[model samples]
Structures are given as C-alpha cells and as structure tokens.
Target: MNSTGKESRHVNIHIASPVEEVYSYASDPANLPEWALGLGGSIENVDGQWVAESSSMGRVVVTFSPENDLGVLDHDVTLPSGETVHNPVRVIADGAGSDVVFTLRRRPGMSDSDFRRDADMVAADLARLKALTEPGQGPR
Candidate 1:
C-alpha cells in the first residue's frame, strides 16, 4: 500500500507477467485512451469529448504522458481552476506481477457523493487497465 502525505492511493493487482510488460503497455497515450474511462463513467459523451481542451466547462488540459518504451506514465493534468495536479502512476514488480499506484495530492473539492462516484469510476478504470495491459487481452 502507498500512503504519501497528501496524495498517494495504492491500487494493486497480481498480473500474470513481469513488471516490464506492464510498464511497456501503459506508457503509450494512444493505448491509454482505451482505459481512460470505465464502464459507467465516461470522459466523453455524445455531447462532448474529454480529449477536447474545452468542453461545456472551461478549458481543461487533456494532458498525458509522452510515449516511451518503458511503461512509465508520469503525466500532470491541470483542472480549469488552474490547479496543476500530478497523477503519480508508478509500476513496481510485486511477486509474479506488478503493483500499480496512483495518487492525487489535494482533494479536488468534490462532494461526498462525487467521491463515491469517482472512486467507483476509477476502480473500474483500473480493472480495465489491468486487463488491457496483460498479455492476450484486448481493449477493455
């Protein structure tokens, strides 16, 4: 588990491969868009696309990691409020698989209901990522 001062959330999964494989798959931004949103939560919709810098809301930076052979996704996103947040996503070898960690330092000032909804949304997204990064798996 990862517990950093203000921003660390640990999400671990026992993948069936080495850490390198998991890392390689996650570094690509294009490949990443597939797992960006989970089943119910969408980063885009019929009315708007999350990739757009500006949707109905003010301009939001749709930033992502630059593609690299190594599976390191250290991307920072800035909300419309001018709050630049670093989404620390790290992958480490754990036993026969990899342990993935994602963290957000300060609270986004979201409501309690929003928290629960976001948690479920992220949890589902992580599951989708696990399946996508593993070998012999298709887009989630």
Candidate 2:
C-alpha cells in the first residue's frame, strides 16, 4: 500500500518466500548494497558501524536495527554531512509468502519530484529483494 501523509510514504512488495527467509536476508546490513542501489554499491564495517560510499552523499555510516527474531528491518543512514534519515522496514507473513514494506520519509525542503524519485528507487529496491529471495527465480 502507498500513502501520502503528514511526514512519510511507503512502498512495498510481495515475495514468494517464508517470512523467516525474507527477514534473514533483508535484515543484514551487509546485504544492503545487493538490493538498495540508491544507498550505495558496497558496504563495510568500520569501528563496529557499517559504512558505505555513496556517490551522492559521499562516505556515510549506517545503523541497523538490532538482531531479533521479529521481522523488523528498520535502519538509519547518517550522511557525510551528519544528517540522519530513518528508514522503517518490515517483513511480514502473508499467508504462505512474505511482504516487505519500506517506509520513505520526506525530508524537510524536499521537492515533490525528488520524493517521487525516492519512492521509485525504493520500489526498484523491493523488486530486487523479491527477485533475490524468491525461489525458482533469478534476479532481473
């Protein structure tokens, strides 16, 4: 479901996999580069924090939700300029499959077009996650 609200919007995708399987892969910050293209191309650990080199944001650190059995995959990305953005993600069971939801919050002073672009990027990322976690399928 997509919604326009006081502060945020969301993009979600359904995957043909169990919730545990989907959560296991998506919860790992090291795997962010494999799916979250808008974030960066690579992720590394530096001083116990995950860092990535973003072409747009330069070098940055990311703080991911702690390891847990629940399907929460929220995280925070701290930009080189010290600005941090919160990303709320969840993987929930849908009958026999799973649904991955990503919440994209609109930053202050962001234009409409840029917010739309961010949503588009998140949709693409979810598609990538679906392809990655679904059985009997190959990534596009």
Best by lDDT: 2
| Model 2: CA > 4 A from native | 1-5
Residue 17 displacement (Å), model 2:
0.3
Error of 1 at 39 (Å): 13
Model 2 lDDT tens row, 58-81: 898889999887799998999987
Q: RMSD in angstroms, candidate 2?
A: 3.4
lDDT of 2: 0.87
Task: Report the number of backbone clashes for model 2.
Answer: 0
Query: Candidate 2: lDDT of 49?
Result: 90
User: TM-scores of all models?
Assistant: 0.65, 0.92
Alpha carbon lDDT of residue 107, candidate 1?
58
lDDT for 128 (candidate 1): 75
State the lDDT of candidate 1 residue by residue for 19-129, as single tens digits: 777777766444554675521222332243234233323444545666554546676656677776566667778877887766534354555554455456556666777
